[model samples]
Target: MPHFFSHNFLLLAGLCCLLPGPQNTGASDLNKKRESTQCQNFAPTITNISLFLLQKAIHWPEHTNLVFSPVSIIAAFAMLSLGTKGNTHKQILNGMGFDLMKMPETKIHKCFQHLIHTFLQPNHQLHMTIGSSLFVHKNLKVESKFKKAAMELYNSETIPINFKDIQAAKTQINKHVMKGSYGHVLKVVGDLPIDTVLALVNFISFDGVQIGEFEAERLDKLEFQLDTGKVVTVPMVKRQGKFYLLKDNTLSSWVLMQPYVGNIMAFFILPDVGKMEELIQNLSHECLNSIHKRIKTRSSNLSFPKFTISTTYDLKKVMNTLGITQIFSNRADFSKAIRDEHVKLSKAMHKAVLGVEDKQWEELDFPDLHKNLLPDGPSVEFNRSFLVILKDITFNLPFLMGKIKDPKTK
Candidate 1:
């Protein structure tokens, strides 16, 4: 039997545990009272509202690590002040706090139909959490000013005393996801709406993917260079209206980087950098070569999405940062399997395309395709802003796990 430590040791250990003391009974009482009260003013400030949400996200007794579900957080804010006065508002708030959000798309007010639909659109985890927080937090300030000014104007108007101004704030992402939606994500005008597409155009201004009457001559030269590996100067054609990538496999599709990052975070729920690279390599060596050989003998001119091959060294650097270490056992077998699958897929695709005409390709426009431009573009400019999100998740994952810090870092 070992001797116990003195009273001083017990007191010091207890102090370090952060357990609430008897002196702070009133603070606990206030929170306990808040649990029962339906006070509109409880989360009045951005700080308070954020703290309220953060407490649920980080400090909840369950899942002690810094694991916050972005979907939960965004849905929480989206539905937080939905209909404050009626049972609808209460329901919305309740829905936010719940684990799985069946977005009450039907019940949302008509004026906020877009907002309701926006909730249905898929959002990146970090984007959803941070953007929704900023969205509600900003509106808290705006509504504060607006509330003091317009009682008579509002009362005189036809609508009811519906102050549930579903804060109509738009981040860079909202432009694509909420613009022309039918299912959750709305459709948009053209590829120009995608950030990376715009960035690419700015980086390398070319005549549109399709050759028009005016662009016919310049496009001929460009096509020649692509085919023969000979340099040719191509002229610029000012696109009067928006142009979508005329139907072809999206060589530079945004699916490469983003979903990969999300999947790693989401534990490979969908494709990410590693898979995308393999797909790209396969497309270039097999698909592009096959297309290249076929088109050379064709009477009609050819068109495909232009892309550049980075050196193996450059590719290695990009892959490493994205955690793309090639596992020894799986890659070759996976590639072979993928190749076999693509072979079958290609045969089916070719059979399906037998009756289709060239114009059909041009008419193919993925209006709802929200192309991610991050990982597809040049590695030099892939913005590290998203690292903040991954970093936050990192620092918090340990806390969420309830692991003691090295005692030094803490």
Candidate 2:
């Protein structure tokens, strides 16, 4: 079996913001609280976008695992909207679940600027990088204002490439994505169209270590039941410790919150036998907030599967489904981005990678509490399909959301 520790492991990557350290002064504390409040206010929009993608993913084949970064997609489109005008700009913002009347264009960009800056802050426990880049043809003249806004607001890079040389252009774009994602995603653009004038690329990479202990000797193969009644063997890591566990009767699922070394939490939702569809349908931003409020600390034995997953998406089609059709059509307007030429978005690509390893637990400084308390709590084995949401606890934002049908498949 291919384990998550392997070098080929590809996990979902998303935008991650660092939490501010403890402050002693009253003024600093007040600023920290304000930052937290701002993030909380902006979180619902991103979460709604993730839910829309998840609902669309249900139409995919049953065996196919789903993984994507809502934060990355939103940031990329938000950056693109900087150069867009008229209906194109409105469509992009509206499709992202933002109301322009309440939050104008300037406020929207400022919010993203704050997010990108906070996301790039130094954090030792969690290693993450997220960025967007625009690859324009060498002959094209991009407006200085658009370039300046993209750089100052979104921290995005604008690179000029000679599209006439298809292979070189592809390699150049791929290298940018590789560097931004810290080499997790090797290639994002496979081929460049002959008339490709501009390409927008977004990449995010996230690495977090476990906060609990998992003995290597305890790693064993266990039976994993699929949704279609098929059983498969998978590597399972077991540990008993204190965690936030919730049994939601409304959704017919058990929610387990696992904390990482940093201010990151992974929520594992296991539906009862065949209630995956019900859980998926009932899942929403409001529902998740409710779950967060109801979850309580308890002792439990957690048996989680070790796995890695990666996904690449054609964002043009994905955005189209969300009613963002002008950017890909001939009527597209990017006058703010390019000067004296009508340039529409030729290609939009996004890739994310994620890997979970049991070895990460070895680095944690947890005490041996499982030995004395293993028999006192319920055993929660993830022996079937489940949903995973990786959230940044400080901002109350879920960056990556995935459905794990089979660990072996990835």
Candidate 3:
């Protein structure tokens, strides 16, 4: 495009790029330009002409580059395609405690990476049914939600004055922030004495009111005794170092636009995935079956527990069958081992099928599946969602879970 019209523009642009010295239009400088004029005039022109020739060569319709332009090098090496965020949306959300399924379009190299990760994640094959599903949630609204969990564990939000001697709320926030990265820990989160980063985690994992109610309720549950040995983190409504709840953009503006406001009137149906099923069921269905209510999307679109768990569960189902067999094989040779552990396994299976495990629970870890979302290890977040753009939608992912390293037994 630039070649045809700007004979001098192309030359000038290249000269500006290549020029080593400072720009000065004084007589001294003009004399210097003239003295070195031959060398200066010749170099960039050769560069421009060579570039034009290379384009002309590749014009017969072959992706060939004899000399690497910055753009060409990036494309050829498959480097420019990956973003710096280091995790795809699915990878970020995977173990973050949510049942999410997101497959926004991405590059070809990146898709294969996601496939490998999906493969490595724990599956249902030899296992038949998942008793461990009880360990985890069907979805985010259940497991990660502090308020709802607190209410179920200890009813009521306003703490009974004497029931629990509460500690003055102590909040922990990491002030150092890296813009465009999840590196900085800005606020606290969760209703439990958990190491969970509350606000951001909830913003990612569960709904907002659930976050608020849970924090308030957890405060109520904390007996001063309970606060001593517990290493719990709480979510603050404010940004880092600030002492107030961050204002909701919609609400702040609605303060004026609202003709009348008892509360917002909206209907929302956040589809459930995983243990989130039970949590969703526990709540009044204002949107799913149908109800009138105020709908709150995540804190900010950025604060979503991203999990593009493949909706194409064709592979997942096949793998589940394999998991069942591997975990519970009784070929008679397993006499000693089966005799020892079969009791526990059977109990787990029975509990899972009967829905008792979800109630009488313990911890269970699934295969960690993250490295698969995109290649080059988590394409960066160029936009709000930290997504990479692609023209086609393919079923494959970027990689398979290369290996399953047992997470530490905390």
Candidate 4:
């Protein structure tokens, strides 16, 4: 398990909310138009933050297999900002790569509301759930306004608990997370600090079935080389078909786009030997846009590993690096959340889990000639470290991103 500190986890834990129903026919269209505009304005910010975190997370020590939900982290902090004041509020928004003057606070929340609602909608191909739970001290008096926004916008549940009873509080939090993630994430809080007054948790769960027409019997152990020049054997899935592919000489990387059953697209980026760092440094919003625009369909043979990866991060240090330090310091101001006393966030922890299904396909007998023949076109094999992004094509936003260094590593 790779451990790092960052503010993205809260967003994942709090990414889910109850789907809002239409009040009436007259207001539905107007509300949707407003939400569409907000989402269009908010999509780029989410992409920038997702890519930025992906770059920072890959550099963390022992992060051979990394996975996280950027949408969840953004939503969690957007809810937190509702309770913050002064510089604390500014830092949270600014750290998320949002411009206060252009977007403002209200618009930001509305945008998040729209984004979360989109994810909660029913999809036959994808099973996804996003939700948030706020465990606050029993004595703490939460402002009505903050509570209302957290519930309405983020669908966050604020449950008061006795902070003195640490074990009970911890159990309650873990239970909420477990239920939210459908038991994929068993425990999020092992221990709660003695002085802890509030614990904000967010979780997101995704299960996607591949829409690629690949023979399951093609699954076999293949060589996966690490950056250290060591190759290990692992189960690799093979597919041959027309795919949207790109070969960027400038970045020395091959980008392969794979679609799932839903409108979800997964972009697998395999850099040329030892070019991972350069690819990361050069990757930007515009570069990604160009890649999306320029990728052409071509017949190719592709092989990618089957693996499951999870990450837990302590976001205090990471937030500080992003210029969000006030929330963790003595000068912290959460006046809007709790007006009765001074409260500074002591700890911010985030954990995310993602799995690509490994199906068991029975072996089939085939002729020697058919087995030996290869598909016509370029052969791209992800038998090494690479980046994978799960994006929603509808909104053009990234929900999950990760760097897979070793398929065998859990």
Question: In terms of TM-score, which candidate is strongest?
Answer: 4
Q: How many pairs collide in each candidate, listed in order? A: 13, 5, 62, 13
lDDT of each: 0.20, 0.70, 0.17, 0.72
lDDT of 2 at 243: 67
**Model 3: number of clashes?**
62
What candidate 1 gets wrong by more than 4 Å, as runs, is: 1-83, 98-266, 269-410
User: Which should have the higher TM-score, number 2 or number 3?
Assistant: 2
lDDT of 3 by residue, 152-220 (tens): 222212111110111211122111111111332232211222211011111011011111111111011
Candidate 1 lDDT tens digits, 215-260: 1211111221211233333322221112111112443321111111
Tell me how far the alpha carbon of residue 58 in candidate 4 is from the true structure, in angstroms, after superposition: 4.8
Q: Name model 4 segments beyond 4 Å from true.
A: 1-34, 58-61, 209-211, 215-217, 362-370
Can you write out model 2's per-residue Cα lDDT over 249-283, one digit (the tens) per residue? 99899998767533567788999988998888889
The candidate that achieves the highest lDDT relative to the unseen native structure: 4
Worst 10 residues of 2 by lDDT: 2-11
RMSD of 4: 6.2
